[model samples]
Target: MSTVPVRTGARRVLDGLTRPAVAAVTVTVAIGLWQALTVLTGVPSILLPAPTEVAAALRGNRADIARHLAYTGYEIGLGWLTGVGVGIAFAGLMAASRRLRLAVYPLLVSIRIVPLVAIAPLLIVAFGATLYTRVLMAAILTFFPVTVATLDGLLSVPSSQLDLLRSVEASTWTQIRHVRLPNALPSIFAGVKIATPLAVEGVLLAEFLAASQGLGHAVLQAAANLDTPLLFAEVALIVGVGLALFGLVAGYERQRRWSDGTDGLGGFGTRGGGAPAPTPERALFGAVALAALGGSWVAGTVVVPNAAVFLPSPSAVAASLWETPDLFLTAAVGSLHKLAVGWALGALVGGTVGAVVAFAPRTRPVAGPFLVGARVTPTIVAAPLLLVWLGISFSAATVLIALATFFPIAVATASGLTTLPETHRSLLDSVDTPRRARLFVRLRYGVPTVLAGVKLSIVSGLSGVVIAEWFVANGGLGVLVNQGMRNLQPTLTYAAIACLFALGMVLFGGTTLLQRRLDW
Candidate 1:
């Protein structure tokens, strides 16, 4: 009369159905809570529309939503394809030549670190807010991740494999085709997955800035009119689009894993193995690359007719910096302060929640769905609604930054906590360690992963601050950018952008150095 086989079968079935079951239950509870709050609290529909109201709005405006979705979908599709193409090509080139990698990789990294919002206005000026501008913005956003991912994949082919190819006197192309490409496919798909949602974000940001007929535009209009239900509907649509794209990529990745029978791809892991010893060759090439960039900027401004109106010369931007040092300094301080505060708050909250979920296995099933939703929901779409709810203020911006910073930290913290060695946990349990002591030990062991998340949060916080300022706050680089764009002062706009880029580099570089020092 043994029930072991029946128990094992039950366990298998439970494990197989757990994820979807959790997700379904979470959604049901969330919708119920939303409706309950609105109905029981007597909150105005303008402030917090009930779930039913949102559903009605969706039903009433299906045609309009569909139209906008179509436009955004087109932009996302075009921009994503273009970005993947360019990224793969550039990654291949950099992989092919050591000198090129040394000379250009730093520049690419810098460009990628600079927030697109900082340059969106400049792009609008240069490209006149056309479909091209939107496409380019999306492409720019999608490019860096894909390039880095592909480059990592290309370089990750085992030395043994390379040697094998060399022994056969394989040409570089043959080596890549036979050895690198197949090995890199998983990583490339990983990049594609990362890039897909970002492509949606890029298009939404562009639409917010310039487009007349997209979900972004609708969001702005909804905010302006205080049409809460429509705003929710639009945001819902945007989230749906992002999730759809993300799901497609995730499905592909799952299929790939099943097909390849691998645990994970090498290239999908963290970049820059560790801090490298400084080299003269790297320094020299970096200098050369910077000089070339400056030279190109100067030439574009001086040689092209009225190019200074859009793409101002370095000297002109430098002059603007000199003339308005106070303005730039004030804005930089405001942005940095907000970013710091918001990032700290987000990390604190995310870490606590993640720790709790990790410690309480039962809680994870309930929390997982909400975490996924937060991670996928674009902060830009939430910004306008926040502005309306919270008003145009620093608090609003800080909230946005917190929202942007929270999910990554939470995910990282959970990952770090869950990955603790079983031996460590067992030893603590055997010793009957206090809960607090066990938690402390877990955090100490997880510092490296936590810090890695922090490093990422730095950039996320910076971007959040900029976008929040663009929509809500009166001070910061975002204000400088908006005014410069409206007033048609390209020099001021470019100068503000340059300051932001420098600030980002400093923060990002410092974080990287700290993470390295910690051997994270």
Candidate 2:
């Protein structure tokens, strides 16, 4: 009996290795094929470098990569810490006060939609492109997801638990420390890990805006010099770092799984962190927050010399908009078209694939890299290869947007799909529903989860649209933003930024309407 049990245990261990082995083999074969095709076709390395060429470039440019990486590493490390600290503290404050939550959450969500790079100029004006500016940009980029996730987790603690604490007459502080904080850990980790790659992209965006010593600057420099191999190598390093950070957080979450009972990454405690439907009270508070922000902007001009140049007055920005009303209108239309197309494509694929994957969750391990790559392949990294293949076309830009939006939707969809209500599951089983029917039959139940993903996607999609215009397209609000930045025209940049903000509000407002319509 003992011998038989040992043999079965050994077999189980071997079985567990199969998917990893296959994944390794698949990657090796893909690389082998890539090398062979490039070598046989004699394609120019500038267009599509072979793996060996990229590897050689990596080795050759070790010193340069190291130098740039040091700056980026510093930005990411400090930014991530700051983001976590602020995000959690702010969530604590909001949890402690309903009025604070009502005031701040809506304003923050609206601000989060601006392409993170666009803020670099404002920061540069205030802080002079120093380490503080770069770190702050990254922290701001990372703040929303963490705060939303933590806030939701804290607020959504089970009624049973709250009642139990109340029955014992536990102090609010004691209850929060023992119950809310502990249960919120899973969601907290979920947001932190998800934001890790965003932090990397954030630092890169800051580098793009104004920096000489970082991977983003290095990419632009290499592209300017037409050094394709080095560009690919640098991009690979970025993707690797993002994946490594994700793996680190995910591994820890797994180890702590025994104690985690609340929804993992899927539910995010509540639908991904949009503010609750507005009441008159919420509207007044949100308006107060916006008014305060606007007041601060006005106040800054009085303090800074030459504020008109660096921080254009609202009237100047508004005048800029009026001056080129037609230009902005045209650009907004084109940008919206591309945004819609890419979002639709990503949503379709993500929801479908997520559903299929929900039926076979064992696939997640092997599928992990591709899913992570979808997010980590920032616009800066994709610029060269996409331009090479698509030749500055709409398709390339759409793909870039899709890459930004797909991961969140897919993750959320898969999570939601797994949670079919018990009654619904049994009903379907009793009728022997087909797999295809089953996959979508309960989609209504997952609408909240999927809607959460869609909201997140809209934010990321806006960022993609900005970068797409910067690199691929010739006309868009993004082009205006880039041109304004390059020309040292703050009013023009701010005007373009205002258009982007308006565009974002439109998209988000539409989503809100759709959510209300569904009301699932």
Candidate 3:
């Protein structure tokens, strides 16, 4: 009996090791298959280099790669710090003034909605192709998410706590320092984590579009020469930077006991306490916001010499809008179509996979690594490869959009499924419900969470489409932006950016409305 028990324990240990073993096997097989495909098909190295060739390129150009990496790192660091500082200041101002919050919050959100990639070229034109331009691009990318997150955290203080502070005669600044800031630390850290990879991506985009330094520039150069091995090597280095930054923020988050509950999608699970109801006050605030924006444009044009070269006057942008309505309309429609198609596809596939992983526990270990890779890999780094594989076409742009949209949806869907009440699952299990029925029920329960992810994905998908168009595709707002920058037409560039802003507002607003209607 004792010997039999010992044998059973040994078998159990082996069973516990099975999943890891299988995962290892799966990875090895996948890599082997990739190598086999390239070797057997006689594909040109320019189209898709072998992994070994990539490794060799990495070794051959290690010094150059490292130098470029340092440049990118410096740019990202400065820009991130600048953006975070500005975000903190803006958030503080909004928190202090109710009128300011009401008048300017929507405007800030609108700016946040615009894809930075689409406007990177405009930034180049405005700031010139200098380090400052790259840093500004990165800062622009970092600003919105950080500001929104910081604002969300600042406003999340409970009314009771605020009331207590008020009764004690605490000033606004005192309340912020003593209560709000501490309470918002977790959220601010969460936002920092969210902004980290984005900062890296922003630097890459700026380098690609403007700078002659950094990994992005190297990638572009390699692609131009059809040096696939070198291209892959540079991309891997870019991914490394992204992952390193992500890891640093994540490590800090863990140390602070902050979990990535919403997978870096801001305002997903947070309540909007400072949001004013639609009333005459809000109407007045809106009017004030428009006036402020108009005044700023007027001031820029009047106060600055040759302001149109950098900051095009609103009238100029409007005139461009009127003069080339079809051009703007067609580009807008094209980009929107690509975004819609790609976002839908990504959501469908990712949601399905997430559901499967949640229901089938046996598959989690096997699928986990690949999902993590997808989440961490910078899509910008892969843009050149995609251009090679799919060519300069809508298909390539759509693929990039899909990749950009997939990760958040999957993570959110999986989270939703896993967090379903045990009692609910037990009830379903008691009835011997079919697997499909169980999945549907879980999805229905998680609709709100899924919608939150959809909102984030809308922005991401838009950004991806713009990047793809800038690099590969011949149409869409990205192409228009490139054309504008090349021709030195600030009006055209600003008009395209304005259209992108409008597109973002529509998609984001529509999703939000749908979420409210569903009451999810």
5-90 per-residue lDDT for model 2 (tens digits): 99998668645776557567557877899999999999999888999999999999899899988778888889988998899889
Q: CA lDDT of each candidate? A: 0.79, 0.77, 0.81
Minimal lDDT window, size 10, model 1: 258-267
Report model 2's TM-score to 2 decimal places: 0.87
For model 3, state the Cα shift of residue 16 in Å: 7.1
For every candidate, C-alpha RMSD to the true structure in Å = 3.7, 4.4, 3.5
- Output the lDDT of residue 133, model 1: 83
List TM-score per model, in order.
0.91, 0.87, 0.90
The 10-residue segment of model 3 with minimum total lDDT is: 265-274
Give a tens-digit lDDT track for model 3, residues 359-425.
7776677787677567667678778998778878878877888889998888778777776689998
Enumerate residue pairs that collide in model 1. Answer: none
- Native-vs-model 3 lDDT? 0.81
Candidate 1 lDDT over residue span 392-463, tens digit each: 987888888998888778877877777679998899899999989887887777777666677667767777
Of models 1 and 2, which has the larger lDDT?
A: 1
- The TM-score between candidate 3 and the true structure equals 0.90
> Residue 161 of model 1: what lDDT?
90
